[model samples]
Target: MATFQRHRAFPWLLLLPQLAIVAIFFFWPAFQALRRSFYVQDAFGLGERFVGLSNYVAVLTSALWQQALVNTLLFSASVALGAMSIALLLATLADRVLRGAKGYRTLLIWPYAVAPAAAGVLWLFLFDPSLGIISRALGSLGIHWNQRLNGGQAMLLVIIASVWQQMSYNFIFFLAGLQSIPASLLESAAIDGAGPWRRFWTITFPLLSPTTFFLLVMNTIYAFFETFGTIDTTTGGGPNNATTTLVYKIYQDGIVGLDLGGSSAQSVILMVLVGLLTLIQFRYVERRVQYY
Candidate 1:
């Protein structure tokens, strides 16, 4: 009995390191953020005071925060949809290619290795109004291109940069999902006189639902948090705070503005928002996500 119990506990023992890492890194910082949310810290970190819900109320009531929230939602939705749609299309095409498929897949996946900041900088150079090739081309066409000053243009640039950076990651997943669908099933559907579009809608698309749902959740989170580097490098949350997202606002307030309590409160709120969003996806969206 003792030996059997020891063996039963062996797996948990092996997992202990990972469990400790999670607790120390993820849970500990989260706890600190929660604790700090209720306390106002002096700018120099020399003093602090318990302010309770005032920080939360201030963040929630602030007009700037409200704008940031809206921007975050719009940015997240656009990036998720744009990246996933393009990725799915590319993956489908790649899967159908009999020749150079490996090379094509490698090219599609290479962009994922580029750092987010690097991706942002690359796009920025391409869109630089004065000297960029694309910008110069647009200039000749009489459509002035200056993202630095135009709020809409800045937002659009950031969205494009984000989508470009994320598309590769989504492509890999979509390609794998596409490849996983049994060829025999598609062959059978084709033999039944189903056209390419009909076959895709009736078979491929439905079968990819699980992967699509998963990517939706991940891409949403990526847009909310991971795009910080891209926005920082490209727009810096930009002209008149047009592209200021919730994550960017948190960094600007907490790290740059030195409003520790308010930022912590914002962080806590963001955590709750992400948690709720994920829960909603899993609870409702999962029903439609067909798993093979």
Candidate 2:
């Protein structure tokens, strides 16, 4: 709300574009969804009638919603942990590389720039049961790699694709965090008979805590919201809805099933859950993060 003393409207003018964008794209839709969550309409869309908390009650009590919730938790956690771990390992190796480092870094970061849907398609091609290269290779090894028929295989395939899509983003942050670390502390540790593992555990890891904490939050959000496109393209939440996440469920209800009220209620629940999660992380998780 602060403004210039001489021209009070200048700061407001400067913020107008961003404010307008947020209102149009985020706030307005959210308000509409909130208003709609409490109402129900006939199949033909003749009229909508407010039904108290019927939609919310139905959604919460539904067995499908429960399953989606479980799947979402598993998928989000797997993607966040898997992506961050793989990215950290790659960043560590790249940091130690003395030759062709730029090329290595560029190749590693290329996946981050790939569109989520495109990345999903790439993996889908690689994991297709009959025609996929990797799938055929697995079949040759006596492993039936049919994601289309196997629920576990479908979930695993989605997790791998999601992790690969997110790894580059984590790599960039982790690499920056690694490079920001002062070399002196590491050298002193080495001089005192500390090995790479000990130095990482005691010195490097602590310094990277802030970056790790940040990536944890960002990755959680990404896994929750941004993976929708990837899931849609790859599995379409298929194989008996095994890979169907909460967000995907929302889409299934709203767009596919045409259950506007239920979908809106689910959306509100999702929004609250994500907001609560972020608040919890900042309130509690950040306590362990070392900024200095």
Candidate 3:
């Protein structure tokens, strides 16, 4: 029994470092944000005064914050849906590769290794108004693509950058999920007169639900928080604040605008909002997931 207890304690001992890291990096900052939310601080951090819920009220009532909320929802939805859909398609195609499969998958996964800022800059050049390869191609086709002044175009540009940046991550999970599906099941469906599309809908899709659900949650989180670097690099949430997401707004308020209290409130709200979103997904979305 003592040996058993020692063995059980050893696993937790291994986890101590990770726990310390999370506590220091995540929980500590979160606690600071929560505490700071109730107080307005001097721009230079020389002083702070407790202000109750006024910061929250201001953030909730401001038009800019409202617009940021709307933009955040739209951006998150677009990035998550677009990335997952494109990744699923790519994974499906990659799974069918009979030759050069390693190279094909490797190419698909290469983008995931690129930092978000770097990826955004790469796409920025690709879509730059003048002399960009894609921009010139669009101009030749009379599409007149320019993100500088057009708010809608700017939003689209950021969305595309975010989707492209996250798609590689989604692809890896989807490919793994696809490969894990039992080949015999597909063969059985094929033998049963089920067409490819029919078998896919009946077997492949349902089996991939676990992976899809997981990706949905992770991608939503990515869109909410991780897209900041990409959006910053690409659009700067610009063209009249058309692409200003909640995370970006928080940065603008706290770091740029020097409204520390309002920014802390926004950060707290964002954390709670994401937590609720994850719960909602697990509560409602998980019902559709077929683990087997």
- Candidate 3's error at 173, in angstroms? 1.2
TM-score of each: 0.96, 0.96, 0.95
Write model 1 residue lDDT over 79-113, tens digit each, in one string.
Answer: 99999999999999998999989999999998889
Model 3 — TM-score against the truth? 0.95
Per-residue lDDT of 1-292 in model 3, one digit per residue for the tens? 7777769878888999999999999999999999999998989889989999999999999999999999999999999999999999999999999999999989989888899999889988998998679989989999898888888888988899888888999999999999999999999989989998998899999999999999999999999999988989989988789999999999998888998888999999999999999999999999989987
Q: Comparing 1 and 3 by TM-score, which wins?
A: 1
Evaluated at residue 221, the lDDT of candidate 1 is 95
* Model 1, backbone clash pairs (residues 3+ apart or across chains), number: 0
lDDT of 2 at 120: 94
Tens digit per residue, CA lDDT, model 2, 151-265: 8999999999999989999999999999999999999999999999999999999999999999999999999999998999999998889999999999999998898899999
Worst 10 residues of 2 by lDDT: 1-10
lDDT of each: 0.94, 0.94, 0.93
- Which stretches of model 1 miss by more than 4 angstroms? 1-4, 7-9
Q: Whole-model lDDT, candidate 1?
A: 0.94
